[model samples]
Target chain A: MAELVTPAERRRLFTLLSPAYLWLLVAVFLPLSAMLFFSFLTDMPQDAPDWGVTLGNYAEFLTNPTYSTLLAKSLKLAVTVTFFCVLIGYPCALVLAKSIKGRSREALFLMVILPFWSNSLVRIFSWAIVLRGNGVLERAINFVLPFDVRLNLMFTTDAVVIGLVHSYLPYVILTLYLALQAVDDDLIDAARSMGASKLTILRRILLPLSLPGLLAGAVLVFVPVVGSFMEPRILGGRMGTYYGTVIEDQFVAVYNWPLGAALSFILLAVVIVILAAASPVLKRAQT
Target chain B: MSRVDVANVTKKFGQAVALDDVSITFEDGGFFALLGPSGSGKTTLLRTIAGFYFPEAGTIRIGEQNVETVPVEKRDIGMMFQNYALFPNMSVADNVGFGLRVRKTPAAEEKRRIAEALELVQLGAMANRKPSQLSGGQRQRVALARAIVTNPRVLLLDEPLSALDKTLRVDMQIELKRIQREIGITTIFVTHDQEEALTLSDRIGILKAGRIVQAGPPREVYDRPIDAFAAGFLGEANWLPEAALSGLSLPGSPGGRRFATRPEMLSISAEAPGEGRNAVKGRLQQRVFAGAMATCLVDVAGQQWKLVARDRDIPELPGGGEVWLSWDPADTLAVPA
Candidate 1:
């Protein structure tokens, strides 16, 4: 349907596109290119006089079982956190988008996204205060209950998941809310008129229609959680050693830039593969 | 297969009365239309019967079952929305078979019934296609197929044909009537277009301000509207001025009564009509020439009266000249002002 562009029009189009392309080049491609190049080196050139470019960092990843084990562990943690976020977020989104109306919906939506206003570290530390042993959650439970109980929840995998879910819950809720809001209420009514029960309508009508947004939210939560190091480090304590933390150590503590870059590239490859597997369903959802 | 009756139904949203003690019976296998303007509660009545909204005080019966407290899914009703809400994820066949599948019909029976419904709508070949791939009229046929496949006791249509183009709307109106006859399910449809109601319905109920003003056979309601609102809403009514009714033996007590005649009933002539006919002298203001028909606007005693007649039947007249509008006394409709 597009007509052939004149040369002057092509020049204008190029002028319009240059700024965004230039920003992508400077901000994304350049850094990725540097990392790819550094991933093949044996050592940093400035740190060692006998510096050479080699495949030693990638070879070390293949030889060391510890790297693969930690990578698996990080992927498991990502799946767990994404699962909980979806489990808690989808119903909240449905209630907010469909059941509530007018000004109250707006107010509730504001409350849902209110966590994004504060810094991530501040939110994570707040969770630490509530989830710590003998903290606010424990004190509240004790005051309400007849017997006392020890709640030693600090510096654990559950603590890390709680902090991460608190930080990333809004992303799922926001995406699912937009998708659920876009669904026509009349469609649900039509299904009901056909004698479809509530469960049948949810299974046959709502879920398939909103699959795109659900996948988008899951990917948004999954990618960051896979590469997360700060939350696990702050709340996971001795159990905080993941592939991301090990990659962080190579850059900051160990000063092994080549190994860190190689590990980061591997994580990127895994994420890309997961996305590639889900792209077919996402493409079908568009129609 | 069933007659639907609403008895003293009153539905309110907050303080606004949507349906005020409305009662109407949709007879078995009858095609009924609820005709009204926007905000006139025609759709509200349709939805109330569909069990989408329960009335605050009423008893609704479908066949022998009391259904005022029933949910839409349990009411055994088929409702086609204004927008033809076919599921985007399902094929035409699946959309048609949704209710059957919900009822846990056997797979072979479901397939047979889906094919049968599609065939009824003449969309048998489009079974595998998605609703989005079909054209507007095709999608309408698919919605019809889906609604009827379940063999629901009642069919509720909310302006289903309003979305189609003029030619297609006429074609689908005939198709809808034929399908409804073949199935013989009680149907209640809501529409604002008076012509569509007259063309498609066996009986018409005219609503104004959530009350049924007039309901009867199409010709009866068209010929004898109970009030001015019903008369005006159902068709164009040309008021016969009080001065013009001076010497005529008007129907009913002429005290608080006003008379009106249908546009097509009045004949325009240069001279007064013969005996037993009512005639009024008026100045011809404008004549609009449409194909096959024409409209003459006449000023009768400081009021504009419209007369519609066949273009060939109307004679050429001098511009702004005197004309007489005449009609039989039987054509005079009396309504309280």
Candidate 2:
């Protein structure tokens, strides 16, 4: 009776899942659990034996207007960056999918993806070079324009958006490209032959078929841009008074690990809400 | 009454010439077919006429207007692609109504035309269903409906029935002929299947390597081929070597030379016929009984000849037995090497 209790059936299931379960426990679940636990604890400065459960850290971040403002700024930046990425990405994807001819199309596609292959730090530093005071781009623009204007190209909200768009444009292009390429070209030709003009074909057939790619690309751009710390910190410079700095200050400089952990959890919750909002659009597009 | 005249149409993609300087004329309401193998430029020719592809040098006249520079949508010609090309997102009624809608016909008139087109294709019940939900043949009918909805002057079909199964293809061939007759529009069908071309076309144009090699009625092209290519392409023919015709006077051959014989035209017997003008004595090489008829292979003058005959009161020559192969002089066709 003991032997036949459940092991005979459950053993196979356990074997089937043991590796993935172990990985989740060791890599993902354990770290999240530690963060959750640490968020509620208070520790003494440079001393032992001060661990206690408390809501003070959560209260300080939630109640503080500065932290709340930083959070809102991050979201606004993410939305703006995602919008630009999608607008630019869709036409690039369409060109890759439909317009460019044969081998040149493949070469152009490779050029679009080439920037992403470089290390992110190098890419960020290159932006730093171009956006700094009197960089090459600034010099070139000044030479072309009428007046000698040191255009404030870097360390602004616009600079942050530019960096974000540069960083995530590849993702948008790749996802939208996949979606656009999957469209049955015959459908487009059919519309044209049936007397639908080129504009009508795009409006009726091409756009709808590529909706899933647009949704996926939007989510991919938005989610990461929301949580990004480097580009805004590097490009925004002093004006980069965003949520990442606040969270970093709490975690690294202020010695308030719990508060920083709490802030991270709040950011995670925002991401969840975003994903929830985006999922329905994706599902609707699929059918 | 709209007649189509294509003069000196040529298209080239890079260095590869897709369509040579080919000219063809279609009378108003003529059911013509462009028959050829793959890469023979039939589709390119059709697309050029439809104005999708502008030729390197040519003029395409529909009625009396030269439409070489006109865009595809502005040309007002209907085209049915091989895969039917029905919009997956649109319902059958919407698909059929697309042309009328494009022309900006009123909603009531569009609805009436849509209904009539669908009725013509016998797809009235399937009006509300999307193209993906329909069968292969049904989708083709919807494409037909869509093409004919606006009453275009010329209808172009690019191997429209090639995607269907063999039986459905035959059924659709009959249906296509019937529809073309009823519509009385200048219809140009492109297909590689010779039988389908013969069945559906009022006139057939055989293309080879971007040029029309022969153009005539299907019967004339089949019964009286111009050269070796047409003879081999139209149907089965036993091509005899030139050296085999020692005593027959063949066309274009200065001396008595070679000719080709269709298997169905040649008669076989154990004893030689008394009044045989084109007769050769040989031994039976192989015999294959195909239910109603038997196909016999006879080796004559260092060449093998096939004879197909009905099962009648004829002596059956055993394989390897002596036999005589003969055909009527009228059945022999002179072919160039």
Candidate 3:
């Protein structure tokens, strides 16, 4: 039997949770509030003397084609990376969870996740070195083939995609592996005994069953990739003028802190909408 | 309907043998049960027949075709799992209609067959409900409907009723037998429950350590089991005392073989020296009374003999006091030691 939760018990719970919630309040809510306030202003208070609350920061985004174009490009980039991650990572996760057995599965699973544990910046840099023109990747290809070929992928949109895919693939694999593992083996056997073809089993049973986890992993990759700046800065080089880098330019280079705050708030709004849309699917996958 | 023949089937998992050179047949439209203790390979044989497993050595003939190397999907069989294995995402009608859909049955025909199958199982009203919304017995009916909707040659049931409570299990048992008889599909059931096997199957094959111990009708196997394991496994038994054989053995009893009698066959007597009946004197160890029937535990010489009779027929005997037990010579059964 449990004791009734009285006002004193409620106070105790609040005390226990206050430290973590208070940290979130100071670290997340306060900064978001400050950004909202700044987005409404004409200029940063620290630099301009004649600063006043204005809608010009948002109006600039509406009028300027460059910011909206780059935002569309960033959204497209996030979609491409999420597609590849789910495509390649889902099969890898299926093999890890179902085909592999015992000790080697553990070792292989750890190897798949080993990349995310390392510095993401370092991994992106490594991709830059391997994919650059006349680099190790080209040299290896030349050694294998009889003809010389230029594999100049660095500083291109392709380079940014490659780098981002490498960084986010492992996390999605982990999510999908947990989902595929939960699918009962007997269900597969039952399907087989019913004369369902392999493709039919995967389509009718496996896909429907594991959709929630797959969607969850897709969301995880998409949200981060949309706001990604450092990867594009390093890998995209001259080609990497995404919405994130533009937002960065406002804060660091252009000194338009008010505009950056408004753009950041818009990105947050998009992320919330995406999560709200996928919540129904995620909830269905659980049962 | 097809008469399935499994000839000399052997299966192994690593070095451990799960089935060893086993052979059994199912008469077309006959209900058969594979009964055994756990780890006795009854379920393994059922799975092999269902084509979930391929034997290392054997020829499995379903009617006229050899299905030893054939894949499961092409084998054309319907199986009900221990948990019923109904697709939770689909409604009852859809779940039952899944196999028909896979076979590309037309919409109208599929609907008619699905409706007929559900009607056969008496679940026509619950066709739109999900399996989760149904009770245990209802889910069982749904599984049966799904398995039979395709009209597979044989139906394989893996402990389908073990999930239900006692009263429900008995009710489902009758329902299952009636449905099987009505459909006339060759059915093979797997269970470790001996009484369930006896009550349900027209014939039973008792397995032990991957081999068949006995195969016969329920009454034949229960009354005249070829060995001690068969006799003991099917039901209870009390071995006739060898030391007091000449004294207690009637003149007309079968000679030169070990004898045993069922607990229920023996009767309790207050007086000794019966003329034509087999009789023995023993001390009353305990009396277990349940309604009109009661069982008395008696110690004769060094062995304990059990006698079950009517509560009124069992005389009031003090514990550790002598009591006479009797049975006819014809009731004495010979069994291997």
Candidate 4:
């Protein structure tokens, strides 16, 4: 191996790493620090000269029941969407990684991830075209059944969840496919050769072995969905006024950037806590 | 204990014939080895017997039950994979107890059996350790313990000792034989290593091109191979040209085929023996001194013959010089042309 670091090499190392680190500082850390500062203020500095530091933005969240309710709604939506994505994606990944072979597996994996090639918001809008009152979904359901059916799912929470699941399902499957592919086929054979049932093999071998990837995919989906405002607004219509939309309103419509920053800071704190709690179990599952 | 019988078993993967009408029988409580070169269907036969790959055209019977349609899980068998395949997440005790748990054995009996199995492998003290925490040899032992804890009717080992270093492998061979003997389980071991097959098995079946070429005890297969393939596969076979058998008659019919004998059975000297023994005069082609033993390649009538002896027993002889090689005719064997 070559030596990775030296006193004279430090200049070259700094040159190689500075571009990415500087981009992160300018693009992420600076904005986050500015948001943290603004979250403790009474108003945006551009709005008035008398603006000063205040805890009123955070206190509004505690005193008003609506913000907490909307936050809970957003969190619940994230949980439901993550659950559906995992439930549907894991088996698809298993079939891709284990059952299919060679060229066909690669083709099918590409098909599964094909949705990710397009913009996610476009996909959500496409779902709106399919799930409207007199749309393709209702017609298809009616065609399958012997009776007429109306699927006015455009403004429902179910529509929002369906769109979100479609958006994130590929991520879960990709993680799980790589993880499942790494598991030795001989281990499954060893288990089956010992009189283990199919369910036993899945519960004890596949699930435990793939848990880390599963949790990673879930966290990735959950974090984005918690802060998502576009998909719900596009698909849920009047029913889409969750915590994310309230924050969006504060920034763009109400001109209350401080309150939006306060809400964004609280959500970030929640995400960090969730990640910290799950890290230990995730670490064990990896091995 | 159970006897496993594979009768006229044929298996094909799409257009490729992996096993072609292979037939063999493993005796009750006998340690049997399926020996062959890679892609010779030795592993296919072993996996078929273990119920992993069902044969296309024949029956596999464990004891008295024909298990052609039986899935691997329903078959009463234990198999150790080539890589050991110890569950990385489970403790040693948990891995051993897995089979018992699958069988729905009572907790108390499962515990006792797991302990007994671990003790049999001499890994009882490391029950709580994960497989990752153990050495390669220890991981192999844990895999063995896990396989046998359920007391299945047949034990299948798929090149189980190939991963170990030579010293550890020899020790494990003895350990494996002891455990199998103690349990009195019918064992079928698959290996391409002929010495491992000869050393470990009570009965050996030699396979080629997905068919059984010969099946017999180790000595029978080595000393009386049915063909040149078997003779050369199990060990070295020094072939004697037809011209060398002119006046010297061998014990067997010779059947107008090549004759061969193990190198160890031949003796080299500066002078021919004054008796009715098979003797030939040749120039020593090359002498190789491997530790403790030496081999001389002798060219007799343009045919190369080999003779092995102890390093000290090989009298001082010039390399590429004239020598006389002799062996008892009874030690002679004939191979198919």
Candidate 5:
């Protein structure tokens, strides 16, 4: 057997832990440092190192009502999309957990995941192809019914919301179904034997037990909804102007990088505070 | 106020028949046991009575109502599961109050009943705690409390004590019997343990292959088994070839296939000279001195049979020495093979 090492020999063991240490520093800390530095540095007339700090970018975002309104609008849209996702996902997950059996359930689960396998841009474009003005959806409606109603649904706030919800619903359903599956069948039977109605059992037992996954799915669906860009870019041709559009303009079109970074920081802080406040309620919902 | 009657009930799961056509009557307020090995349909029968499964054929009547069409929640039955399925999230008070709440009882009455039920199971002090914080036996007590809180007409127990250790199981058995007698609820207990069934039941229904083999009082069923399977399953019995007991003209052996003898009924003597006592010549093959009795295995007429006798009544005999074995006419039970 080998002898145990002293402090001096143990110094050699620290070398084995370096790969993960170096990876975290390079991947996370370095990029974050560049973002912070860029936010502070000024692009001056002579392109010199001004090294001067200013609150101009922060003031511009805070005082300008358009940016603030866009932020509020983004929050509202994210909430609406998240609410619909939960409403639709819960029943879908419940049915998946309770009713389906064997290969049929597997096939159904795979079908729910199929949309996510294609590229996001292509999928969004497919919806645009159908819902665009005088497109297949409008044509089919006109062909079947006598009413002359033309739908130009491609680039609007409603379109963007629909796209976001469609993109994120599979995740919500999958997470909720996994949680619902963990509930004990014996609990349901016990409740039934206690003279509880089916509705009462669902309200008192099934819904409460599956709440953790519901909250987790809501968070997963909501956080990205507030920060989404592609859906708004593709579908919100003019009518939709979420906070992501402004963030994208600052970083991509306007080249005013500091303002965009400040807006991003504000969004991050708001999301953290809101989710933390919701954690207690979500935790209580489960079990 | 009336007994439960199950008449020619059969349940089929696809091609596998879970229960054959079986009929049995449970006396009003009677403590009956459905005893069998696994997959023998004891649990299924209990569940059917609880209205969990509808029989494919036949009628089940509780009191005077035909419960075949009644749903589980409307069946007016209380049930305890094998796993003691207490609601893990709710406090003991809430769990016990659930049935009363469902029946729309007044809050004051519900609270009083919950307290009384908890005290019945000796869990009055732990009403504020969750089931996850309790021990297996304590959780079981809570389950029992929850089931009895509503004063249901019939109580169903599905192997309720199978999860406990030996000491706890015995203690719970006594407690459960006391509770049943005090409440006087028509109770149907399901278990695979023959001793447990015998110890707790007023009448036992022994089942095999989804059919009832014998249904009677514990003593009668054990003393007068109808077949070989019944005699062997109820307890330990020594089986002898039909010819061995036929030669001696045992009372029940006119057309009987075999004779079954309990170990305690066989007796040993000092020597091998006997004829009027229906003695067989044999040598002592082995002897075991149990605390209260000594069990001896003797080879009689080239066949081995076990005999038990009180330590004081044990005859002085040497191992490998020839001896005479005899038993009374009433002790031998004859059964078809």
Candidate 6:
């Protein structure tokens, strides 16, 4: 196989790949490398001539409980959002992939992924309008109940969860739908013919078979939700101060580039550990 | 073992009728094959009997109980699909034990039954392997083992051996028959392969366009097809032209009736056959050699007639010349034109 490629062909292959790798170096790795360098500095080298290299940012994170608390809160929020997405998205995916057929399935699948077409901020703001005090949701519920009710859902953790779930639900549905669609309908028929009930079929066949996709979807949702800031800020108001928002504040509000880079680097480390833990299942899903 | 009686079953898909008031009975502990071309309702009939589809109007009885409305899981039937459909996530033992576990069979009994089923299919050593780790034939055996482990009242096979290679299919056919006989279970299988149907089934039901064209023992149906469709679908048929039937005495009035003879029953020769044999004169078009058997294509009165004979039985003949195709009068089949 190695002898199959001539010298000119090898050069052409390298030439084709160099542009993308060069772009990655300039756009992604270069910025990440600069951030990593800044994370260990005592001050920004741009403005301070007396700036010295230090592990102060890292030491601060270990010494202060507030950063850890906010990180833990962000992690909890990620878990909550992912759990709801799976709970709601899996059945929707199942119906789209299996129960519905022909043109309607295509139309419904388009609807499932339609959220991705709109801007994330627009979707988050739309949820804010729906879930606010005396919003559309409360008004509709009050009208149906034949009694007036005051339901204020805005500026809370629940609002943040709702907005984030709305924004990321499509990821879960798309991955799960692909996985469920790959499962042969004949397996279901075979199981049923063997005297297996619906729940047993789900537990023994469908769930185990689609576990890789489910985990893949969960990881997709969890990783993004942990680093989320916009949804919580727009919907949670004063209550929305997660680790991500603090990282945002450091760069934009406090002008503390070193601390923000350090925090960002720590978050990257956490995400890497998670991906490593999930590599086995994700690798199985690939094959 | 139970006898399955499907009476006046009618299934429709939108405006299209998949099963047009079909009715057939599968005798207890007997092997039956539903044979048909694609879109001929053979599979629809099998799925309907398996409780996957409920006919608009029908009475399906299994062991004296009406079960047309019963859902598939409660029907107590075992089905093997064409592609095997073994759970890839499960080990062979787990795949075989699924039915028993579903029924909440005791742990000891489930293990013993899984072992027994695997042993019956000659896949005992494959118990620990995942389905992906097994070969095609081994996976097929695992599927068979999984299907029969629960000892369901009836076994339904939806072209189960069609995915296998030719030689493997023949071997599986014999193995399947042996297992069915050993268990004394009523089995109904669907296949478009007439040879497989004839080789395995005690009874064969030929379906055409949502109707049962003929249903009888393999030999009976093969020898006496009810119509042109059944006659042509089941095996190769050499139609007897009007000129060829000059003195042939056919059953009933000959008008509006066509007669055909099986390829194997017809003999080819350079000279005319002796007395009591019906013979046709035709120009030899082509002789196709296929190892032990050979096919002679004869153009008789501008109509093609095929005669299958042993390779060595065919005598040396000049290329592209006249020949006599002869058959016994009893071998002639008469059907509606």
Ranking by lDDT: 1, 6, 4, 3, 5, 2
Give the i-RMS of model 1 in Å: 0.7
Worst 10 residues of 6 chain A by lDDT: A1-10
- In terms of lDDT, model 3 sits at 0.88
Once superposed on the true structure, which residue ranges of model 5 sit more than 4 Å away at CA?
A: A1-26, A43-55, A136-146, A149-151, B242-249, B254-256, B263-327
Model 1 per-residue lDDT tens digits across residues A1-287:
56647998888878999999999999999999999999988888888988888988988889999999999999999999999999999999889978999999999989888999988888878888898888999999999999997778889899999888888999999999999998999999999999999899989998888888898999999999999999999889999899999999999999999999999999999999989998898898878
* Clash count per candidate: 0, 0, 0, 0, 0, 0
Report the poorest 10 consecutive residues by lDDT, candidate 5 chain B. B272-281
What's the candidate order when arranged by decreasing TM-score?
1, 6, 4, 3, 2, 5
Give residue B160's lDDT in candidate 1 (0 to 100).
99
Candidate 1 C-alpha error for residue B178, in Å: 0.6
Give all candidate RMSDs, comma-separated.
1.7, 4.0, 3.1, 2.6, 4.3, 1.9
For model 1, give the TM-score of chain B.
0.98
Q: Show where candidate 3 strays beyond 4 Å.
A: A1-20, A41-54, A250-256, A277-287, B240-246, B250-259, B269-273, B279-285, B295-310, B320-325
Residue range B102-194, candidate 6, lDDT tens digits: 899999999999999999999988899989999889999999888888888899999999999999989999999999999999999999999
Cα lDDT tens digits for candidate 4, A1-287: 56767777877888999999999999999999999999999878888888999999889999999998998999999999999999999999999988999999889988898899998778888999998888889888988999877778988999999998999899999998888888899999999998999899999989998888899899889999998998888899999898888999988899899999999988888889988998898788777
Docking class of 6: medium
Candidate 3 DockQ score? 0.65
Over B104-136, each residue of candidate 5 has an lDDT whose tens digit, in order, gives: 999999999999999999999999998988998
Which candidate has the top score in lDDT?
1
Q: Which residue pairs overlap in candidate 5's backbone?
A: none
What lDDT does each candidate get?
0.92, 0.84, 0.88, 0.90, 0.86, 0.92
True contacts kept of 3: 0.65
Q: What is the DockQ of the complex in model 4?
A: 0.76
Off by over 4 Å in 1: A1-3, A45-50
lDDT score for residue A44 of model 6:
95
DockQ of each: 0.84, 0.56, 0.65, 0.76, 0.60, 0.79
